[model samples]
Target: MTKHNSPLLGSHMSLSKSTNYLEGVVNETVNQNANTFMIFTGAPQNTKRVPVETFKIAEMNQLIDYHEIDKSKLVVHAPYLINLSNPVNETVWKFSIDFLLEEIKRCEALGIHLLVLHPGAYTKGSLEQGLQQLIKALDLVTDYESPVLIALETMSGKGTEVGGQLDDLAFVLQQVKKPERIGVCLDTCHLHDAGYQIQNWPEFKNNLKQLLPLDKVKVIHLNDSKNVCGAKKDRHENIGYGQIGFDTLVEIVWDEELTTVPKILETPYIDNLSPYKKEIKCLLSRSFNQDLK
Candidate 1:
């Protein structure tokens, strides 16, 4: 059995739909005995946002403090509607930039510093054009100085998504004007789907380091894929039941380089119930739950 340096383990908790919203998020994190968590300020699919004051920040902070949850690792995900790579339409691209900027402001006000964002799809344009547009959008949004850091999430290459490959992300990082405000969020399922051999840690790490630096990986989405490697589908399964097996995921969770980085589970629910409590327990115990399904 291997031991971790008390890694930050948590899941994507709800912020808007629950009875207590933000407080419920903190409570849910505590329920699972997690040290950090992620949330969307509103719904993930919509642009509609409620006033930040209504989030009950004071109450949420008190709950976080009481539970000794690491506030620095708390994350907020941008709405999926934001597409920074919409090269075909200027209107859509501008809207995406504005929405992302607003989300960053919201995160800053809430005292959260890390924001996870999908790099977005090109749809009707070439990958090169999409990458250019994405770089431009990021530059525009990060022009202002804020404590909030935007983490570009690795995509599953399901469609015309921009971040399915490391070269694309590396190019964006190299071209982006505000490097200090940008970072990366590595999702295990996405990497596996995009055809990266994540199960082979050494080879994958060597290849990854050749293009992207480990320090830029601010967060990790600890998910198991329902599809096999190189499937290009983004379906997520429970920890041990999916293609990316339990032992591999456990290895990632305890990886020395990512020890301080936050690991968030976005696994599918079983029987309309969250499997995080059990999943987190299993990961901490450094063993797989045979009956997790």
Candidate 2:
């Protein structure tokens, strides 16, 4: 659920690298004066997670309250290796399903209600078959009943990755038994890299309304791409420093169709967290200036 009062903006803060995983993620967000962001429960490429103790949960909730960030609107990115579309290896496929199902439970436990997932690649099968498997996995996870909203992320179309096309995401949702349990998180870099022009938010919104309604888009990975549109590159650059110019990025955040959804930065990291702070400052200042006009 989005808050219409302000633009929900924040970045992906790393827990693995932080000295204090739980509190550090929040502190980093507060350091940038951002209200919303995404986190990998563990490393996205590896299936490892820090054991969440009771104290961590209480401390995290305290910080969330102190910072005034809503828990429901928070987003979690699933691991990179969890691939539901692996048609060749049954074991890997099963692991993907199990990890995802467990991921929902973990989110529920922590009171984080939204989880973003990459619809996996079709490693050894056709796109059609891969989508079917993906849908099946989603159905199983949400089969019983779960409050955690699983958001399938838009991909960069790298290699045989399953969900670069908006239509592909829509199709997968159409087949899910519990459609209400799922949502979509559109990544700006992925959208541009997958051949859609980032400047053309109007057309994109029109298409979204026709098939996957804007209401179903709960989160946006606000990023600038290092590569040009249609380059199939997944590189993320600091906002205003990449192919997505600062002015265009301003236009992106101000787009009315996207105003209500939460926007997150998956931008490159600066060791001291200076880069994120600067990016957040840039977004707020640019948008504030637009209000004066």
Candidate 3:
């Protein structure tokens, strides 16, 4: 086995209903020897949420503390159904706001502080209008007192997605009333799909620093893309098995400045089993496992 120097590395663990949801996720993280992880408060596709109280939060915390996982880096992702960028439907827009607030409350209950969210799609309206609406929605959502910070994810330019560009995120940050409650979750796959040539890390980092504060980057979805740069399709490939090769990914993951930010894997599973343990091991050892597919 390769000895490792771990960064704040982890993957998105599923909330298993078969066992204690909270404890189950935490155990998966520990099993992978990961120090931090991300999960949805409920299923990511819909609004169906089990009550937080029943998730065995106390036992889960014990497990987390026992494993020495950093609670602050543990993230809860908002559901896919909530689109804060919806421009035409007022009802959907309001639902998005309400649902996100409720997710924050859930995160508070779980004692997790970071919530990763996709900036959402316009669907039927112009990009500018969608951004304005998104900024408005965030202003309302962040007005309340909460320890949970919403980390807006960079999106693939798929369909009407509003956050594919750094300019879009920068605009939202500038316009939102509560910047303190907002942070950014950079996705390597999304950045590549949306045409940011991140293989040249120095150039990309320099550009990102100009647009967004480095401190505002709270989480990174360290995925490799199934599609090429400028593809605009959001397909995630397993690390080293995708277009973004292993060395580039290792460089990004071990960048000195981002050591504190949790790097998450949202890679595709192989044979219905998680590839995270193998992937995480490969990353930590700084070795490319060519057999990982």
Candidate 4:
């Protein structure tokens, strides 16, 4: 196996409807040869909460030891109900804070190093105001001893999403006192829909360099966009199966500068495992082969 210094390559896998059990999910990813993976800590809907289970924690540790997965390679996506930018009421905001705190606690117990979050929709207010709300909510959460880094994901600019642009995200990070705890998760589909020209390597590199430091970027959501550039849509297609194409991904995966950042696919699952395997093979081929030269 080629040992690349870059973060491990993998996809976000789903556990059952229950957030309490993660053993099967971890095992499935390991069986798929994934050294790194992402999972949602709870159900996607707004109702119901699943408390973390003890056995799942034990299984997670066992898998990590047995598979020798680096503790830093695992990531957990917070639940969908969390809207850091929501200005509805104090109760809602409090709920969001509690949800995130619980998520951090669970991740800490499991030794997961990254938590990817969507920078919430602002609904009926200025983007700046919404950002302030997000910062406030984050500030209220107590810190954990886990090495986990909280990554705010870029959005597709649909509705009132706060982190659609690099500037918006940068603003939030700047306001937050604990800079070390804050990082970025760049979603390819969202970036494309946000009007970033990622097809060209030089342009891509320049854009990223100008917006945020490469080191501040901790995670990459490797998905293709069903919508065109600047469409402000969040539809995700399989790798190379949508508008972004395989060549563009090749450029991204082989970039020496971004090799240290972990990349996880959020693509729709195909009927069988072939699609995931094929995508991984494609990424590996592009990274190691000289055909692109």
Listed per candidate, the RMSD to the true structure in angstroms reads: 2.3, 3.7, 1.8, 3.8
Select the stronger candidate by TM-score from 1 and 2: 1
Candidate 2 segments whose C-alpha is farther than 4 A from its true place: 1-5, 16-18, 270-274, 287-293
The TM-scores, one per candidate, come to 0.96, 0.91, 0.97, 0.88
Please give the RMSD of candidate 2 to the true structure: 3.7
Candidates arranged by lDDT, highest first: 3, 1, 2, 4
lDDT of 3 at 11: 96
The lDDT per prediction is 0.89, 0.80, 0.89, 0.77
Q: What clash count does candidate 1 reach?
A: 0
- Cα lDDT tens digits for candidate 2, 1-293: 22335567888877654447667777778778888878777778887676655326687789988777887778888888899888777898999999988787777777788889889998878899899889888887787587889889999999999988999999988889888988898988898899987676677678678887778998888888899888897998778767766777777676777776778887877564446667777787784222210
Question: What root-mean-square deviation over C-alphas does model 4 reach?
Answer: 3.8
Give a tens-digit lDDT track for model 4, residues 1-293: 22445347778877664533668766766656566788876676564555666437787777777777666767888887888887766677778888788788877776786899887877877887789999987777635445678899989898888988888988877788787888999999999999888888678778777767778898889888898999998899877778998888777766778777778888876665435556776676664232311
lDDT of 3: 0.89
Total colliding residue pairs, candidate 4: 1
Model 1: per-residue Cα lDDT over 37-74, one tens digit each: 99988878887788999988998989987777778899
- Tens digits of lDDT, candidate 3, 57-112: 99888887777777888888889888999999999999999999899899999999
Pairs in steric clash, model 3:
none
Please identify which of the two predictions, 3 or 4, would achieve the higher TM-score against the true structure: 3
Best by TM-score: 3
